[model samples]
Target: MFGYRGLTISDDGILEISGVRCDYLVEKYGTPLYVFNEEEILNRIKEIKENHIVKYGGVAAYASKAFLTKYMCRLIKREGLWLDVVSGGELYTAKSVDFPMENIIFHGNNKTYEELEMAVDFGVGRVVIDNFDEIDILEDILLKKKRSIDVQIRITPGIDGHTHDFIKTGQVDSKFGFPMHDESALHAVKRILNSPALKLKGIHAHIGSQLHQNNIYKLEVEVLAKFISSIKNLFDYEIEEINCGGGFGIYYTEGDKRLSISYFTDVIHKAVEECFSRYNLRKPTVFIEPGRWIVGEAGITLYRVGSIKDIRGIRKYVSVDGGMTDNIRTALYSAKYTAVPANKLNNKDEEQVTICGKCCESGDILIKDIKLPKLERGDIIAVLSTGAYNFSMASNYNRIPRPAVVMVNRGQDVLIVKRETYEDIIKNDL
Candidate 1:
């Protein structure tokens, strides 16, 4: 009902996703299942390709931090989009799939020496240098290996994004990149220019996540363009690429203002053209790394209602088998979401109820004060727009094994990840 493709209500009032009944999925995959619509994901990617990549000759990299799997790696590769990995584990996953290491852009704030070695050894396409210490570590590794790698310096654009404070990365006081008003960035550039192993290709900056305004990105471009011009004047070197990291917002609840892919891309492309032209600099190759936009709306979490508690004149609590461990955004970022009764889609009896998880923490509520069909024990509840961070950020808190992940498309379903077992939880215990 929130406008995800392939979602419909059956004649019998059952909620169907991609031509498959939600109850059938619960029967097969069990409670607390992570279901993704494969066609919806591809459509999002296709939209990026058409609006940003093809229209402006830019690169679209899938930010793997939002969600990553061996299957996801293969899917990204097959779609002709680049992969953005921030840790050695992500790199290993990509390597396991042979996901074209040259198409990979390695990113991390504090990349360990071993991870840098792995990136260098595996011949990753680009390493986004976050700090001066990382530059030194990577230079040392490259010197020891006698190999050169293309690199980009991540700069703090000093622009605060219109998002939560926890997710803001491009602010001046952030720990992510070199600050614009300081000499550290310039010093790092000088060091990289002298180092034979590190090739400084360009600059990158990601303001924040869940960004809604397009003008904010335009301002980021203007700031980076001015910096690039100053760099050319000082070092006489031209930057070949400008990586404008992605935070395009998606529809989660009715209150969220969702913009089209073109809404942001059009502004970004125009800003790059105008600003770079004004600075008299050559137009550089642009790269955008989108994680949530491509996957958020395509995913839904199915939880079977377990318990119902009603307090007279106060509130009603509908507990599910899953909670913060399965989806932590509600507790972490105070994120909002929408849901529906999969089995009672057409039910007329509705009541205001609070949806909560099975975790022991009282703050582990998923949705608060939402109106839904009068719920009962064993009812199937499907929460929408959980496709991005739910599976990737899931944990085994309270020894609760994580749920399986299923991808549905064109009336077909396949389990992409297996549900964790009790033994799997403590398999590393001595």
Candidate 2:
């Protein structure tokens, strides 16, 4: 059974995503391709809009770091969702698509001088200030441009979301934001308030990724609300927006549970309303920056199984054409995923196999010890729930060019990003 909508197994056991057959896509786009179900993405966005943005009077900013391309920018813009960009390259991608400048929320921990200047010049709607040094740099850029920009100070509320240590960001000891336990956040707030070029718009915090607990989000709201109230009492500056950064989890494997959109949105809205009311502060425009939750399940990566190494009394290694080069999550975070032999979906014969990548590193395994229909050397393998960070975090590791990305809908597939070539690898080397 597929965890996400738009995926089906044909009568002959072929896997079809949004009505498009996996083997057909593999033949057309080649192996190691990223196929996103456009309908599923739209459905997720619709859930955000209807449940959170429209229902709660908030904003939905699609976290572009999850997956970004010119086509994706156009899709987000068309759906009327704001974009959260973390780097200059992402900003440029949005700009190249002629996306509305004001709908952009720029974020970066160590935003370079040029990146800040670029954001300022492009008239980004809000810049989430990550640290004290970035504050000075941004103010200088704004002063030079003789323009002011609305900004939000990212605060580490010290709430651990009980996720991966590498992805947990809102903790006090993290390198991301100004810690609230000390005077650093207050100092940063004061600095922003004093600067004529920067307008303090709100407070922001992203606790972690792949979060499932609702209590953690409620607790985050409480912390942010108290901080907002204190800032109002101290500086007499009322924050107008509250960006409870997004980490809504999605299903990756059978063990993973995906919560409903309202499950998070309703709790978030109620928490905001209750906490602000208790604090005697007006409710600000809430913002949710969801990345994985929006597109994770909508995506499936197709790879060609090659060179099966069956070591008796050991593990059978079913190697694919792609590995860390296409998806580093498994190796990076020890992430779990669900994969099947696309060509043999109806076959009942199964064996435990380790889906390894062509990369030289022993750690470049995709799924370890998973039962699948007996995998053949030329069979196509489909790994689900890869839409979020796979393409965005892909690398040319081991000199393997990144795979092409295609958006599939209603049995139609269109390439959004072309497959990289060896020339592209060396294009910047000389």
Clashes of each: 0, 0
- What is the Cα-based TM-score of model 2? 0.99
- Candidate 1: where are CA atoms >4 Å away? none
lDDT of 1 by residue, 1-430 (tens): 6666668899988888878899999999898999998898898999999998898999999999998989899999999999999999999999999999999999989999999999999999999999888988999999998999999999999999989898888889998989988788888888898999999998999999999988999999999899999889999999999999999999998888767899999998899999999999999999999999989988899999999999989999999999999999999999999999999888988999999999989999999999998999999999999999999999999999999999999789999999999999999999
Q: What TM-score goes with each of the models?
A: 0.99, 0.99
TM-score of 1: 0.99
Displacement of the residue 253 alpha carbon in candidate 1, Å = 0.4
